[model samples]
Target: MTQGRSIRLFLVDGTPNGLLTAEIMNWTGHVLTGPRSKLSELVQRPECGRTGIYFLVGPDPDNSLRPLVYIGESDDVGTRLKQHNRPEDKGGKDFWEKVCLVTSKDQNLTKAHVKYLESLLIQNAGQVGRCKLINGTAHEYINLPESDRADMAFFMEQIRTVLPVLGLDFLRESFGNKAKAEPSDDAGVDSPRLYMQITKQGIQASAQEYEGEFIVMQGSTTRVDWVAQPGGYGALFAQLCEEGVLSEPEGKVRRFTKDFAFSSPSAAGAIVAGYNVNGRTTWKVDGSGITYGEWQDRQVSAAAAAAAAPE
Candidate 1:
């Protein structure tokens, strides 16, 4: 029989039998011991059936309850409490990490009751500088209707209070901001420079680029007249299909289903390569054998040479 926090020693029917014993210590640890009897024994006991939320507060060497942790709820408070003090389960270290179950007198420990108690603890835990409630049992209770469950609202509030402490800024940011109307003066600037449209039929891509201060058009459409470029330009066409840019078909092959549109030759090349196509080897500059990559390089070199020339 190990001593625990607050011992309760007594005799059974005038025979010196250790009916129950509990040890209570400040920060060291605590335990409770009793004979293995039927659940009826605990039910019949006057001190049994203790129900409610239990707080596991401990000193952080400074002997202050400022950094308490752990909150728990139990229908069978006494049994849960005993489990916390058992030596088998890491000496109750897991229970004390966030919450602990203590003896409660609430016999009819309904789901609502447990939720309400957990919520109260969560709310208070934040104020007391305790860790955030990592447990999900609190939220489970909130799903119940208030009419059916009295503790739903209480738990929600507690959850709200602790959410900030847990550094859940992403959730707060997402829910806090409301979408506003788009601002004016966003005409040409707002237009998508690239478009990848999916349809049920097939994929198509178009590109427009400035060449020597003149706009040149290049693209691939459903028209078979468009010359098929070599290398992996076909891959971009393939990607359009994979990306669902093409319309959904009942039973036809879904390959080459999507369409891509870009304003810059480089952008189109990038889109092709990014989607796993060899743009350099695939697309050709005009009817020449020069690849997209070779064309881009020549353009860059020409620009650099012109810039370095006198002026």
Candidate 2:
């Protein structure tokens, strides 16, 4: 079982959308985030003057479903941010609308430490493939001692945990670290496997629910043509197609090129069926024929019965 963690967040401007700072209890890292509009205020904070790694985040102009990210490190993040805030003609990026910076609260991070972190962050973001990276190439750093590397690795883990709480999930892995697109036999040890089939259309897809995410496994097939109403799933499918998650039409059907994680079962089902669908009722247990909704209800009822029973 996972242990619960306590995180402290302060809204620097007393507004949800304004500058904010986050700290995990007992952790030495400090995270500060704010919108590009708040750059003037953000740069004024002393934390921005320290050695740290920062992320510039925004929507991808071409792919609506994914974000574009730029990972960088600096001895003085405030100055670097200001330079990036300049006009595009002056070598600034126009796509990023928000910034998230990670610095050590203890002031122990140095130029070398941040550079090592930046490289790893860039590499990890690329491996996750949840965002489009604008960085040219990650620079290498091999000077850190083995002990420092171990410490930085722990710091990186904390960043991973806090970022999703702030609604940044590009570093979150959708498919568990296997390079294989198909689900392995041990894939469902922690979660139940579900399947969706449309015999009439020859559509057959497999999925699994894990940690609140619905993952559509690879090799799932779907209709090549869009039969549903415009927008919503149609828009999302187009974006997935653009991102190469789904392959191009090879006749009347297209296939999932990789396992993609969706926020809900309906979202995954919609992409598979090429339209809106009630995923709860459509996705059934791999062999039992019980709907996802039914299986969920059964689990809840079992837990309730156990709770109401003997001490």
Instruction: Identify the candidate with maximal TM-score.
Output: 2
Candidate 2: what lDDT? 0.88
Query: Can you write out model 2's per-residue Cα lDDT over 1-311, one digit (the tens) per residue?
Result: 46999999999989999999999999999999999999999999999999999999999877876899999999999999999998899998899999999999999999989989988888888888888999967888879999999888899989989998899998876666632453674453335889999888888898887657788888988878668889878988887887788999966678999878888989988888888999999999987999999999999999899999987
Candidate 1 ranges beyond 4 A from true positions: 1-47, 62-65, 88-91, 94-106, 127-140, 148-311
N/CA/C clash count, model 1:
36
When summed lDDT is taken over every stretch of 10 residues in candidate 2, the lowest stretch is 181-190
Output the lDDT of residue 262, model 1.
39
Global lDDT of each model?
Answer: 0.39, 0.88
Q: Pick the candidate with the highest lDDT.
A: 2
Give one clash count per candidate, in the order shown: 36, 0
Q: Following a full C-alpha superposition, what root-mean-square deviation does model 1 have from the true structure?
A: 22.4
TM-score for each model:
0.28, 0.94
Worst 10 residues of 1 by lDDT: 170-179
lDDT of 1 by residue, 141-225 (tens): 4555566454344433333333333322111211001112224322212121222322443443433232111111223333221
